[model samples]
Target: MTDVPFTRTETPVLEPITMINAFTVPVEESERFLRRWKSNAEIMAGKPGFVRARLHQSLINGAELRYVNVAHWESGAQLEEAQKDPEWYANTLQMLNDPELHIQARPSIYEVVVEVEPGARLLP
Candidate 1:
């Protein structure tokens, strides 16, 4: 992905969509779970209504925000349909319910109403 600006046309699609933000625990457990999560792409491939999913890690002030997993879909129905899959549910539950991973976070689906793309900055 490029550090590009979101113009008018590119902004609208993101606005009406629902954004899911997932925060994981520290790397010790979070990283391990993440590795497992990514390794099983085959499971996700068969899930219904799976549009796209991406993982993110905090940089500077990250402890307050450990990891972020973003998934975008055509609609909530499609996403929900995928979740109904037994394999998807089992794999997800295993990673999430791991005793070693003491994850503390809340993920909420939001309807994006507006967006503003920031311009280049002097600081990186």
Candidate 2:
């Protein structure tokens, strides 16, 4: 994925929609989980209004959340539409049906309320 520049203009405030999913995967199935998650993320990236997707793994040993997915979208409606697609149900959601994986996922959506960049000063 190409890096997109995020500029904060003082006159206009922009709030990007974000989705975060925390996954707890069995140590034995961590690799498989990563692969499946990446595939799912790729599919979502192809949809309209997809801004960016990122998967983060905890470096701390024995962390409850082994993997976390943080995705940014243009709006909540766009995200809801993408989730309703049949392709998402067939490919991404189906992965959860596998009992062998023993994966637990908790997902949530949020609106970005504040942002700060280095060397950027707030206008008075």
Per-model tally of clashing residue pairs? 0, 0
Candidate number achieving the greatest lDDT relative to the actual structure: 2
True-vs-predicted CA distance for residue 102, candidate 2, Å = 0.7
lDDT of 2 by residue, 16-64 (tens): 5788888888788888888778777888989988899989989975888
Give per-residue lDDT, candidate 2, residue 31: 82
lDDT on C-alpha atoms for all candidate structures: 0.57, 0.73
Tens-place lDDT per residue, model 1, 2-101, is 1222111112232224545556576667567677668544576656555677777777444766777776666666555555567766665666566676
Instruction: State TM-scores per candidate.
Output: 0.66, 0.78
